[model samples]
Target: MNPSFAQASPQALVAGDPDQGAVLDAALAPLRAEFGTVDLVVERMDRLGNWAFVIGDMRSPGGGRLDMSGTRFADAAEQGAMSSVYVALLRREGDAAGDASDAATESTAAGAGPAAPAEAAARDQAGLQQEDADPAVAAETPRGRWVVVDFAIGPGDVAWLGWPQEHAAPRALFGF
Candidate 1:
């Protein structure tokens, strides 16, 4: 464990570090935009090379809980509030000499909306199957330019093969 991370409270750890804050803010932007203001209670955080996993829950100001539902997460809305997992693959602005920044800019300009059909098809053909492939592995390919792959909210037992690590701390935290 990083001594700093181990010694700090979850909120202090997240609030005190710029990198973690930026990544978490970006990852949860869509959720925030949709749900309005909500509280995030962090359960665990783990760091890999330049990657991070944040596991937590989201609660409304009135203390109502939110849940995930789709082909990717809880599979149905009734499953209730399992924890949410947010993964970020961070790269400092100059690390790739503008490659990552340029891509991030393009995505930002696009409003981070869902890709067009053709673009989605092309991405799949290019081996980035956003729905079926393991996000961790996809982020590791030559396309390390992925800054924040955003968040996943579910229980560890859910068959989130797309993000196999799901709620668990990243494997590297175990020296794997």
Candidate 2:
């Protein structure tokens, strides 16, 4: 089953330690690379088996907003001041990934620790819980290093609909 990474508010994100921050940075490297140092605040995170779903807001490094709503894809560089809901599906690093470390170690090395109880919820109440995870997901092949399975940006409703099914991420992302 997947071990959930604690959720944090936009304000709590700036309070983590350097190592923890680095881990997050590493996890988000793909997003940054595609968006060029775009600003993302993780509003929610849920780990289903080895799959993780991240929901957040994205802004430019210059503090301007970027929106990818409606359209399947949009050029971030072309637009400015468009606030958006960012959603990403991430696969956890498994033993097959060649890394012996677990997610917790990555958190520690990145200087990240648990957020304040008042500010962070352990997991999404409406999301699939550990026990409810599909057994097939735990046995899926191609398991390994962390990967950005898929991502969508827009309003929550629209973004959620954009979750891709062809990627390596578990098909049960929405708890199917």
Candidate 3:
């Protein structure tokens, strides 16, 4: 785990609206598009009272599954950031979201692309036997856990928390 990452316990965060399902569904659109479909499982609320939802395992047409999990933010800015994180994870891993023709060409030709080398190197460095670089596996690997902690914080209350990174992405993705 990255030392800079931190996350509140699921018990620490709380949801303000139990019926924010529509809001959550909208916020999750990008992820749904990328992962084929998404099922929001409200695992727990946060300390600050924001919904903490999880993206349950999503099955793919290719007979694989993507097991992504993250929280939703009702606030538009927070929602945008969360969506970006999910998209970035997919883009970084070269997973198809139905865009980027280069991905297919790269995948078929020498396995070269933005993420392929790093992924290959990581595998080599870890000395793990190489498994198929299937899109399903890339989607399923929990890049990290995330939470929308600061979304609910007032401007004046921002200082009450540690640095944003302590409660945000990278760390959040790992569910710390």
**Top lDDT prediction, candidate number:** 2
**Model 3 lDDT per residue over 13-34, tens place:** 2355332332344334555554
**What's each prediction's TM-score?**
0.45, 0.44, 0.24
- C-alpha root-mean-square deviation, each candidate: 10.9, 13.0, 17.2
Top TM-score prediction, candidate number: 1
Q: How far is candidate 2 from the true structure (C-alpha RMSD, Å)?
A: 13.0
lDDT of each: 0.41, 0.45, 0.31
Arranged by TM-score with the best first, the candidates are: 1, 2, 3
**CA lDDT of 39 in candidate 2?**
79
Candidate 1 per-residue lDDT, tens place, 1-176, comes to 21112312222235555455554554455456555575666665544534455555676566676544333444444555445443332221223233333543566566575444455334423433222212232222232322444445444453224332332223443234
